[model samples]
Target: MSTPAPHAAPLVLVTGASGYIGGRLVPALLDAGFRVRAMARHADRLQDRPWRDRVEVVEADVQDPASLEAALDGVDVAYYLIHAMGGGRSFADRDRQGARSFADASARAGVGRIVYLGGIHPDGEELSTHMASRKEVGDILLAGAVPAVVLRAAVILGSGSASFEIMRHLAERLPVMIAPQWLRNRIQPIAVRDVLHYLVGAARLDGAPNRTFDVGGPDVLTFAELLQAYARAAGLPQRRILTVPVLTPRLASHWIGLVTPVPTGIARPLVESLIHESVAAEADLRALIPAPEGGLTSVDRAIELALARVRELDVATAWHSATPAGAPSSPLPEDPEWSGGIVRGDERQRPVDASPETLWAVLEGIGGRRGWYSWRLGWISRGLMDRLVGGPGLRRGRRHPDKLAVGDALDWWRVERLERGRLLRLRAEMRVPGQAWLELGVQEADDGGSILHQRAIYHPHGLLGDLYWWAVWPFHEIVFGGMQRNIARAAEAAPPDSRRAVNTDTDTDTDTEETA
Candidate 1:
């Protein structure tokens, strides 16, 4: 196969690349061989994005006319995806100002074309402030000398996206819904992926300047119908949605905020936009992009994809643990300037028929160069991840080969206290939802075998913390049990003198194992 020649695909400037819609569009541009200049208020916020490294980052605010000059410099095509839906009260004015500034900048910069995404509403209907703002932005972009293509869409459904989050919250929490008149209002929700396809396609189009197209999925269901469909997709019982014409948009916004994870400020605009049907009127978007590309995703599929994306982010990302005792409890553990909460007195124990020397050796060599004995790979992998997120990795070995001191770094934990061959207490330095600790203590038993006790404890933060704790409980059970068993085995494998002599002045032995 002959490799295609890399022609100049145009330097495209994507505003709001740090936002939900714009965030997903950047990678598509990169994949299509376009030179991209990503614009965002805080470039660092977009650091974790997949296309972060593939484009030039320009720090610019759309509302600032001066900022737009530098942002539009050397840009052939610009995507105006910025929307201020989160800010309070005057968000509509802010949106208009930003759009106007960008339009002026694009014209002055002599940009060939501008592609914008706006909200769609049925023509001839009274529009809400949110919808009006969207229309105003489109109008502003159109006024620019450069040809601008506006693709107006409605209620984008994708995980982490606002509408999808609202749907998720409502479906997940409310079994029976008492909807307002707006609930019966029909809408054409677009899949985020489909929306991106159109945006990417519009970027490369040759003709048509100052044209606006309505964009949406094939499904043109009412708000209530969509809710039912989403509920069904989630495997929940068919929820009854009773629509009452008496409830107004203002009340709907408050109700939505109470039900969904979205704040009232965001939900208010979204509910207001629902006053009119948002089905696509023009089929030009589909004509520009064909079949598979043009095809509108099913609401169920869109909902599933959105939910899956949120899950992936949640599971993969780790929130840093809070500090304890005026000391930073982070795995790095250098400064004691702790910023998180403190945990104390959470403990458990077990006993083994082994001497203090043997037990201590087992504990010190527990991880790193020494395998965890069983499920060791799992432990190491998690430890590495912790280290990557500024937590301690397995690189930090124990202080003494077989002996531990107070405040010695061991893998991802610190030895808080050690009493010769008798007891060893460790405070977890790894970042977790809550504080964690591991304590091992040995004592001489009456039966000539030493008692070895090992236990792990955790304190959860809030609702998320509780969920996190339960979700990982199964893994914890396996790892903690394996760790306890290995310690006993390591002690048994050691020489008889070591097992018999505890500090050489100790005698007797017995065994006990307990966990919580």
Candidate 2:
């Protein structure tokens, strides 16, 4: 079965709708004319998705079978993208049990087809706990009466994808590396675009039930080659990777956790999977879905596109958003006046020629992918320094590029306060010696324009913290001064306040503030 026979959009239910693949998949399915129901345990987290309004969101937990009935009711096809990768050491058992419950419930609901995304099996080699669990879950789905369609793939290349993030950090941070042995092992990788094509195409197939197909990009390369390719795509010099057998998977996983944002639980399984070759033995997936317009994406091309998306801050959803456990609430409660300590500060106030509404719009759109609206090189340097010291750096971009929620993580800062079109306060989370905050205030001026108030407040911990603040004072003026001026200019250059059309980058801003 190649092309799906024509029919009205099926009532499709996608579990783990907030995950990296699932979050991106929802839009693709909608474009293909399918009516989609996105199911996630925490429905609030999915509110930032660009397509959030397009799909129907239902709250469901795999562990609690009772909650899945509504999602399964009247569903024609279900996408089982949920897994326990981040649920700690007991993930395997939980994944297996969850699969059984889902399968049984699907049967009871009279669901027609189950489309599962699983990893390609290692040829005649032992599997890691996560990989083995994936295999077992697929079997569990097929064991039920429903016709299950499984599409197995290896490393998925896309912005905010875990595998690409690991490779990205390795390539960007390390100029030369003492690489693990797995770097020499060969593996097949696939582009997310192609993977979605197959998943959506599978649903249209008139009758390809109970089938398993292998999917991968056209290229088959080693882990070393993949890392080097990413570096080249990012315009860096070809990296030096010296393979060392002494670095075991455990050591490598911990090292990855340090250099990159990937947690030990998720990185460990991926590293363990790298222990075995993951080349797709079968290429029957092409028959099911026609190749993309440009054909399959080569490794270098895939990495290029993925990084471009990151730079543009156009990522749809992140792997971390898959499970929001222990995440800090956005728009944290305001602190007292003496909060982080106002021992010393840099204050800049400018009267913008634009309306208050226009100025605030520019202020609200700061950070995330927009950079600092001033010196990006300095911001990148600070982020890199933070990463080296085991901080989040700027990896966790805003959940939505154009929107900011109360609890959203914005680059190396957290949204401490958001007052819609009036003000935004961001508290620093980088490895600073003490507490710090950046506040932007906009209010209508008596002259019918707007006054922009910018302040940087810091509370030093001790001698070291005080010294750290003064040490960066000279650099701070350059960054902060340029920031206030540029923001004012952007607002001035944009259309009138009522239109809300503003330039994020404009060169005509003039500084009307007294330098302090």
Candidate 3:
């Protein structure tokens, strides 16, 4: 018998590869024997993905027609997952323009098909800006020369999804709630896994016509019932929801922003979409593509899977996966004078009687339940203030207690860069007047020991930012100074066998969940 010869796999271009859905879809496409080209506006944003090296990455913005044309070249299928919700008030216009550019470019590139994931909305009813834009984008794609499959979904339930995050935080933080009347509006929520399954399956629908298909889970329930279901799945007490006719969508979004990591800009659109019922009107997609192995996921099962991922620290992507458009992305300059801005820093260094490996171990395990090395009360106070102002605060916590990768959220700080056993740089997600970063590094010393270096870097925005830095500088001695000293002391005090034990436990400790 002759062995079959391998052939080139069909190439699929995934825009918005840095987002929650696109990030997870890349690995799924690869598993399904498709060649994936992960496209992002900034290619470096995808550098830290676990499958970064597996897929070909292209830097392209959908609004930039030239870049889209180049990115869509030689693509059998293109996934339109990009949206401009974080771009401010003109987001709908931007979404419209981007869809037009992408549709034209895909046709010029001779792409086989286009797959789009859009929000499920009722027909013949006035839609929110978010849902209307989604529907328009789908329409633009379906009208193009290339065949398109638009899978419309309601609330996508997953650990790191925005909808799931909003629901989780509301249920966890509020035992009794004064909510909007939209809580009674019916919705057919779908699991993120099911959405991804349908998306991947769309690629193989060779002769399917270009049209929209409604996709949803096995259960249909109201927002109130969903919250109650989430509480039950998370092992929490029953929640009392008091719906008031006075609470408007804008007010509800602000309330959500204050409690969850999601901000008002993104939350408002989501809130508006929930003002009406969003039950799926048709299940035509299931006829073309079969459901996953066990059939559609139930609401309870989806919540369980999401909670399990959070507990196990195995979330693949988060709503925060994409950096905010206005947030600082530049690296810390070597010299403050060269930055062309006022840069204030709190720097501390300490010599330790421990190996570099031991110091790295302590540094990697700094946040989450382990807590900051010093000034716990001060940190808590600041975190609470941030939360009140619609910030991530400290509740987001580190993804893993013992190990961290770049982009992992660590108590309102994001891991910006990681050089194994050498350097770890964290960018702040907390609400502040300006941008901030905390960098921790370890190096070998001449005395057969390690030297720990810690720095808190801040770039002020205006007069207020500068004043804020000066106000906080007085406490740096207790905060930054003690943090460095305590970290060094921890490395020195740790047992010689603890370094290996930490690494081993990262793989074996799947059941132990860390608290804020």
Best lDDT among the predictions, by candidate number = 3
Badly placed stretches (over 4 Å) of model 1 are 1-6, 312-516
Model 1 agreement with the true structure over 1-516: per-residue lDDT tens digits: 112235766888998775556766788888878889998765544554556678889888876789888778878889997776635567778888888888888888878899999888778887887788889889888877889999998888866565765676677678887888677878899887888888888887867557898888888898788778888877888887778888888777766654543445557788888888777888786766664543568998888776665544331111111111123333312225433643323233556776666676666545434545556567657765664444444534432333343444555666655665666667776668776777777777776677667666565677676776777777765777666666677677778645331221111111000000
Query: Against the correct fold, how does model 2 do in TM-score?
Result: 0.71
Clashes of each: 15, 6, 0
Worst 10 residues of 2 by lDDT: 507-516
lDDT score at residue 125, model 3, on the 0-100 scale: 93
lDDT string for model 2 (378-422, tens) is 777787777665465665666665567544567667666678778
Count backbone clashes in candidate 1: 15
The lDDT of model 2 is 0.78
Residue 54 error, candidate 1, Å: 1.1
Q: Which segments of candidate 3 are over 4 A away from where they belong?
A: 1-6, 334-339, 500-516
Model 1: how far residue 205 lies from native, Å = 1.0
| lDDT, residue 165, model 2 | 85
How do the candidates rank by lDDT, highest first? 3, 2, 1
